[model samples]
Target: MTGGAGYIGSHVVRAFQQAGIPPVVLDDLSSGHRGFVPADVPFVHGSILDVPLVARTLAEHDVTGVVHLAGFKYAGVSVDRPLHTYEQNVTGTANLLTAMADQGVEAIVFSSSAAVYGTPDVDLVTEATATTPESPYGESKLIGEWLLRDQGRATGLRHTSLRYFNVVGSGTPDLYDTSPHNLFPLVLDALTQGRTPRINGTDYPTPDGTCVRDYIHVADLADAHVAAARALGEGRTLEPVYNLGSGDGVSVRQIMTAMADATGIAFEPDVAPPRPGDPARIVASGELAARDLGWRMTHTLADMVSSAWEARRAH
Candidate 1:
């Protein structure tokens, strides 16, 4: 797995490890910590853009398939660092794909984002949703999906692209979303640091006057990926694109309420201006995944928030 030391990537690494499949990880640690990775797994502290390093890892490990979760995820930073996001998200994926192909790796599971849908008019988003990325970060992820699809079509490289929503709630004590960009992390940061969690806006079309987002617990997301990989191996050839989420749109206020209920900490959020390119609502349709991969999510908002709080308290 590439970028296996990062937040979501780390959890997926653990999932693979728990399944007794140790994957060689290629991470530059630009935004990941070595401590997050399991000791049994071999770690290569290098960028996937390093063609030689990636190729060597594939060859050395006899890599069969990859779970790719290495990419920028912040919408705000994407505006300031479009080039960086492009290089890291787009170029890096291209390089990794080339290396995988050269090493005879035939299949892969890509970690895409719901940002590819931009702002959907419909509340329930499906794999058939339009591709209109709202930021450079989102654009990069969409490009990666397209690249994966194109490669599969041209080279018989079977692939699955999972577009995840806000991933939170790691069941493990030490596992959670620790990235500065993730919503759950930012909330926890504010609460633990004696600062008020800030809300982006209070005038959205949502019932609570705040933007709504679909959140899938990290563990459930991990399960979905494993199931997707299994589906790949089943020769079902599912055209490789599925939206992984709770399929329930929860608003900002709803999250605060859940967090407060979970941690007994009053998250008095300071309302602020809207993010540059945020969507008002994004709910996913995991029905396709359920039908194709026999996958189902296991965590609700309350469950996710409470489990996240448990992980956060430990930190």
Candidate 2:
């Protein structure tokens, strides 16, 4: 699995391990911590862009498939560094595909993002939703999907992409989301550093006057990835993409409340001005994934917050 040492990737690695599958990890450790990988798992410290290295690792492990989660993932930052995003997401994906083809690894489960939908005009996003990505990061992910589709046509590569919104919580206390830009880590960092957790744009059109988003637990998302990989291995016909989302949504205000309760913090969050281009709400229907990939909201809002808080504190 590429990037198996990172946040979501590490959780997926553990899921694979729990299923009696030992995975070899290839990570550059850019934003990933080496400790996130288990001491028993074979770890290769390298980037997917290193085509020779990836091919060698695949051959060494006799890998049958790939779980790709490595990339430049910050949507906001991608706007200012479009070239860097393409290098990491687009070009890096192309290199991984090349290595896979070279090593005869014909299956992959791509860790895509809901950013491909951008600001959807519909009430609920689905597999058929029009893709009009607003940032370089989203565009790169969309292009990565295109790469897989094109490769499938040419080389019969079996592939599927999992699109998701905010991923929260940890499956175990030993792992946590450490991205400086992600919500759970940001809020937890603020609280840990003796600063107030602030909520941006609390006057949206939602019931609680904050932006609403689909927040799925990382463990549930990891399960879906494993299921997708198994489906590919079994030659099951699967959709090209699946959205791992909450049918309903949770507001930022709700998240703040949960954080306070979970952390035993008494202070209310400070309301700040809305970030530019911040949508009032973005939620999707996970019905397709539920039907095909065993996707479901296995964790409640409180579960998401409390589990994430526990992991962050342990870290």
Candidate 3:
């Protein structure tokens, strides 16, 4: 697994352990914490761009597949540093594929994003919808997917790119995200820290005027990761992509209200203008994954928020 030390990747690692499937983790510790990973699990501290190190790590682990999660993920950051985003996301992905192919590792489950959809006209975006990535970060993920799909076709590398929406609600309080990228943690931290939780906008067409996004529990998404890998490993057909989401949209105010109700804390939202290129709403349809992987979501909107708040307090 790459980027296994980040918020989503670390949870994926724990889910692998829960399923009795151990994975080798590769992280540069650029934004990820080393203490998040268990000591018994073998971890290589190196960038994916390091070709020699990647090749060596694959051979040492006997890795036949990967959960590719390492990359710069912030939409705003990508905008601020397009070149850096392209280099880390695009070049790193190329090197990962090369190292994997070199070692004859033919299966991969890529950690894609809902950002690929951009601002869809439809409320619930399915896998069949045409991709129109809005930002550099989204563009980088699209490029990564294109590379994965094309490479898999040429090399018989069975692959699945799970297009994930908002991945919130950390199961492990010890490993909550400190990064300023993710929305849920950012809001929770701002509120808990006594700083005002800023709402991007209050003038969207949505009912609450705040941008609405599909929030899937990290654990649900993590389970789908293993299922995708297993399906590819079991010689399943080359359907290499699937949308993974709750199919339920939650606005910013709705989330804040829910957390406030649950925690008995008044959420003082600081309404600010939406950032440029901010999509009004992004909701996804995950029927394909549900049908094929038998995946079901366990958390509700309240659960997702309350759990994050609980985890935050614990930390």
Candidate 4:
């Protein structure tokens, strides 16, 4: 698995191990932690941009398939760093595909994003949702999906991309989202550091006047990747892309409430002006993934909040 040391990728590594599939990790550690990958798993400390290095890793490890999750993932930051985002997400994917083809690797599972849909018009987004990405990060992810599709057609590569929504919580106490731009870490970090968490806005048209998003536990999301990889390895036809989401929406205020309850720190978030282009709501239907990959939201809102808190405290 590429990026097997990242927050999501680390969980995916564990899932693959649980399924009795030994995984070799190749990570640049730009944002990923070297400690996140297990000590037993083979680790290749390098960039996918290095075509020769990637090809060598595939050949040396006897890799049969790949679960790709490495990229510049901050949507808002991506707006200011478009070139960097494209290089890491778009060019990186292209290079990985090139290396795979060279090494005769036939299958792959891509890590896509809900950002590909931007602000959807409907209440529940599905795989059929038209992609209208608004940032470089989103656009790059969409382009990465395109690269996979084109490669699959050209080389007969077996592949699938899982479009992730707001992934949160923890599968293990040792692993959690550590991105400086992510919501959970921002809020949890503020509270732990004796600073009050702040909400961007409370004036949206939504019921709670806060932006609503579909949040899925990271562990459950990781499991979906394993299922996709297994299906592809077993020669079963899978959809080109699947949205790994919960059909329900959770507002920022609701999340704050849950955070307070989870951490035993009751404090109202300081309200700030709304961020530009902030969407009122974005939820998704995971039916397609459930039908094919046994996708399901096994954790509840409480489970998400509490598990995240526990993990945050452990760190």
Candidate 5:
């Protein structure tokens, strides 16, 4: 698994270990922590852009398949750093695929994102949703999917991309989202620093007025990824992409309420204007993942908050 030392990647590493699959991790530690990777798993400190290193790792481990999760993931920042985003996401993915081809590793599970469907007109996005990415991050991911598809046709590579919505919560107390821009960490950081968590806007058309989005627990998302990898390894015909999401979504106000309840902080959140281009609602249907990959929303909204709080406190 590439990027196996980051927040989501670490959880997926644990899941793969639990499933009795030995995982070799390659990470540059740019945003990933060395401590996040299990001591037993073999770790290679390198970037995916290092094609020779990637090829060597695959050969050394006799790697049969790959779980590609390494990339520049910030969507808002991607707008300002388009070239950096392309280099990390686009060029990095190309190098990894090239290395895999050289080493005869034919299967991959791609970590895609919902950003590919930027500001969609539909209420619930599906696999068939027309991709119109608004940020370089989303565009890079879409191109990554295209690369996988093209490689599959040319070299008989088998692959599937898992496009996720907002991933929150924690499967283990030791692992949590550390990104400063993510909502969970931002709220928890405010509380820890003796400040009130703030909501951007609460006057939208939705029932709660705050933005509603699909937030899936990271552990559940990891499970779906492993399922996809297993299907690919077993040579089962799989779709090119699947959305790991809840058809229903939770609002930002709801998240704040859950945070207050979970952390025992009762102060009302401060309100601010909505961020530009912020959509009022963005949810996805996971029926396809459920049918093929055992995807499910195992954690409730309250469960997501509490687990996340516990993990944040531990950190």
Candidate 6:
């Protein structure tokens, strides 16, 4: 699995292990942590852009499939680092595909993002929703999916892209979202440091006047990857893309309330002006994934908040 040491990737790696499918991790440790990988798991420290390296790793491990999660993932930062983002996400994905083809590794599960929809006008996004990415990060993810689609046609590669919503919480106390830009880490960090956690915007046309987003548990998200991999391995025809979402929306205010209750920090969040291109609401329907991959939200808002808090405090 490429980027198997990342926050989401690490959890996916663990899921694969629990399913009795041994995984080999290839990570550059750019945004991922070396410690996230298990001690016994095979770890290769390298970038996926190195086609030869990837091919060599696949052959060495006799890897039958790939779980790709490595890329430049910051949507806001990608605006300033467009070239960097394209090189890492687009070029890197192309290289990974080349390596996979060279090694005859026919199956792959891509870690895509809901950002491909940008700010949709609908209340619920699905696989059929039009893709109108507004950031380089989102554009790169869409391009990655395109790469897989084109490659599948050309090489008969079995592939599926999982479009993730806002993934949060911890599968275990040792694994947590460490992204500096993520809301959970930011909120938890501020409270731990005796500062007020600030909400980006609170004037959106929602019930709480804050932006609403689909939040799914990381553990649940990881299980979906395993399911997708298993389906492909069993020669089952799967959808090209599936949204790993909860078909529900959680506002920023609700998150703040959850954080306060979870951490015993009762202070209200500070408000800030809306960021550019910030979507008011971007929920999604996971009906397709549920039917195929048994995708479901096993964790509640309280579970997400408390688990993240416990993991953050642990580290």
Name the best candidate (by TM-score): 5
For model 4, the superposed segments whose C-alpha errors exceed 4 Å read none
Candidate 6 lDDT, 1-315, residue by residue in tens: 999999999999999999999999999999999999999999999999999999999999999999999998999999999999999999999999999998899999999999999889888999999999999999999999999999999989999999988899999999989899999999999999999999888888999899999999999999999999999999999999999887887999999999999999899888899988787999999999999987787999999999999999899
On lDDT, the candidate that comes out on top is: 5
- Each model's RMSD to truth, in Å? 1.7, 0.9, 1.6, 1.1, 0.7, 0.9
Report the C-alpha lDDT of model 2 over 212-281, residue by residue, as the tens digit: 9999999998999889999999999899999988988999888888998999987788888999888898
- Supply candidate 4's per-residue lDDT for 152: 89
Q: Scored by CA lDDT, what does every candidate get?
A: 0.84, 0.93, 0.86, 0.93, 0.95, 0.94
lDDT tens digits, residue span 207-269, model 3: 989998888988888899988878888888746678987777789899878877867778678
lDDT of 1 by residue, 1-315 (tens): 887888778888888777766678889888888988988889989997899889999999888888888877787799899999999999999999999888988889999988888888788999888888878999999999989989988999889899887888886878767776678878877887888888998988888899988888888888777777767766666856888866777899999888778878876889999986666888898888888877788778888888888888887
Least accurate 10 contiguous residues by lDDT in model 1: 231-240
By TM-score, how accurate is candidate 2?
Answer: 0.98
RMSD over all Cα atoms, model 6: 0.9
Query: What TM-score does each of the candidates earn?
Result: 0.94, 0.98, 0.95, 0.97, 0.99, 0.98
> Model 4 TM-score?
0.97
TM-score of 3: 0.95
lDDT of 5 by residue, 97-120 (tens): 999999999999999999999899
lDDT for model 4, please.
Answer: 0.93
Q: Which run of 10 residues does model 6 get worst, by summed lDDT?
A: 290-299
lDDT of 4 by residue, 1-315 (tens): 999999999999999999999999999999899999999999999998999999999999899999999998999899899999999999999999999999999999999999999888998899998999999999999999999999989999999999988889999899988888788889999999999999898999999899999999999988899899999999999999998888887999999999999999989899999998888899998899999988898998888989999999997
Q: What is the lDDT of residue 184 in candidate 1?
A: 85
